[model samples]
Target: MNTWQQAALAAEIENQAQVPVLSLAASASVRPSRRLGRPTLIQMGSNIYEQVRCISAIVRSYHWRGVIAIYEDDAYGGNAEMLTLFSEALQRVGSEIEYHLSLPPISSLSDPRESVYQELLKLLSTQSRVFIVLQSSLPMATHLFQEARRMDFMGKDSAWIITDSISSFLDSMDTSVIPYMEGALGIKSYYSKSNRPFLEFSAQFQKNFKSENPEENNTQPGIHALRADDSIAVIARALERLASDDTNTPKMMLKNILARNFSGLSGNIIFEGGDLSNSNSLLFRIINVVRTGYKELDFWTQDLDNPFRREGRDKNSSRNTTKVLDGPVIWPGYLIKRVPKGWEMPTDAKPLKIGIPAKTSFDKFVKVDEAEAEADKRYSGFCIDIFREVLKILEQNYSLPYEFHPVIGTYDELVDFVYNKVITPISSL
Candidate 1:
């Protein structure tokens, strides 16, 4: 069997019609894995959906209605599938993408036209304040954030969200990149730090690895090592099961291995068909970049509505049991004690054109007085009164130069208008 770092190796193995293969890394795309059959090929590690919830939750927290995605363009195992899943996750959280920018692989970074720095310049000029960066390279991310810093795009009103790929890499990242990443947030895989099994396994691995590599400076085990450990354990278990049944082919052994659930250094291990147990089953840690380094800000789970939870966490505690972030966050530009608004009015800003549904049946709920000919139509109703109070609340933080516009349409149209951004919903006044 041949081994390689590239995720495309799994697909390549199938093209050769070789023996059954297994991927310790999650980067293996499910599409190709399924084509090879569940028993023939299996991928171990968290899927995209598990990681995206954390990112979507951050956008939802700021009440950002739109976001721009900047992802790496790689055919083997890249951001295309991740972007699709992430966009869906955002939609589920009542947010939509404003734009998607693709950056070529790091190998192509030397080319000026494909440089991420050039792309960052374009992103700087855009109106979307929230960005989801799904690049797999830490060096590219460093360059990206450095350019953003130079462009003054890292501000209190703007947000930069990263995925686990970059998050895990930050642990050993260069200190030079830290300053550029200030006020940035990241969504990374969360392994229970308090889990005794994991802690013990990590310590043992570190000691053994140090002994194995005497000259190596850093002996810290990464996600790959954990995956490798799980893979070895899986193979050993399969070997034991193989001793009992001579008729069980390699495919059958692979099937038995996929069905087996156990605990490992990474945490609980299980496979659902060729994928992990649950696409949304993974947990993520939310972090913010600071002058010193990154700090733990919150936690995110599958519950999209209440995804972020505060620290002082218990590993065994459920997501529903956790709270929001503990204290004030230090935003970009060294600003302390404020959350980014995630948006701003355009230069050609206009009054918030509020869409009020016109109704004949429930006239008291929303009566559009067409008799009063005015630039902004007159509206009086119990519903209008409720909306007015919400406007007052909004005015405290933002300018509420709003004008009521009556829409002679069905309830569906009113919703569609809001969804299409034709008019702001008065319900969100």
Candidate 2:
């Protein structure tokens, strides 16, 4: 059949598929934890006008004038719209904007050290004013900060403004400077839905899958447990429309979703101007390092009346632009800081043996030789690859002499190993 006919048949087949609906979804089976988790999820995005306002406020407040935004030189980074808004805003109060440069994403940089650093030095020499970084990757931010610190680029003259791309722990403490990255500010997002529309979504989600949950446990799955919820949410709406309408049109469903508002567990998502790619976004602010972490100062939401960030206004002067929180806009820096109290690497660079759960959803997904199920690959499979990345990062960045050596151990074997050796000293430490 033709392409349209093929899509039509697939849509029909999806409806006929025996997959359980979200309303009658089955409970997720739990497996034993084989290794300790050092989890930090980082999602990246582009700069919107709201981000511009919030970050600009913090930067200009520090008495520094002018800006030099070194972004990833791609459609995602060197956005002309965002650059114009930021540059214009910076110039509003007579602040001099020295430069706005877009570098390649770290993923594409074949020669990150020489090429990235050389271009950075060029910006440093030519456009050394106020630094505004817009890298979409955390590793790239770390590299830049590390290089800048090694080059002794911190002082009264050189100021920086970054985003949530860098950790707050690194921001305030200035482990590179060992004292602080004082005066440097940025924007970060860290609000649970429960804090706002959180309870509403939780209540509905619990209702939707309440029957599937084991009655005895009497508890909803954790936030982590809801990781699969996104994929389900996207597919669920499609299935529901297909089931209810019997038309099973993707374009129509897409139209319906865009016409209305969607309040997800993350936040309210709205599609505007037919850009299904989710272009316009909310903005947040990082005030200053409070203690050993970066704190969120404010937010500039798309909604004018949102009290989350600051008082924003529409032409009508109807909604309250600023959201007034329970307390002053303050974010505890440790919120995003690395917490490795008992997990710190020692001087000897000991390879802290980690017992892998020999056959986990994570591990089973990585056995390349075996023919894998689509669901297994789609859901549980990325764990091993993720674990490898973590190990690689630890080996590359931390005090470890060698890589984080991974050893295979079963559930019972891991339990015994932890009980006899690993658990004892760590508990005391």
Identify the leading candidate in terms of TM-score: 1
- Badly placed stretches (over 4 Å) of model 2 are 1-47, 75-78, 124-128, 164-183, 193-235, 275-283, 287-292, 300-429
Residue 162 shift from truth in candidate 1, angstroms: 0.9
Q: lDDT per residue, candidate 1, 270-334, as tens digits?
A: 77656555433447777877876678867776654455555665644544322335446677766
Residue 293 displacement (Å), model 2: 3.8
Q: Candidate 1's C-alpha lDDT?
A: 0.67
Model 1 spans > 4 angstroms off: 1-9, 15-18, 27-32, 35-39, 76-80, 111-114, 195-197, 204-219, 243-249, 279-282, 309-324, 344-429
Each model's backbone clash number = 1, 12
lDDT of 1 at 171: 53
All candidates' lDDT scores? 0.67, 0.44
Tell me how far the alpha carbon of residue 170 in candidate 2 is from the true structure, in angstroms, after superposition: 9.0
Model 1 TM-score relative to the real fold? 0.71
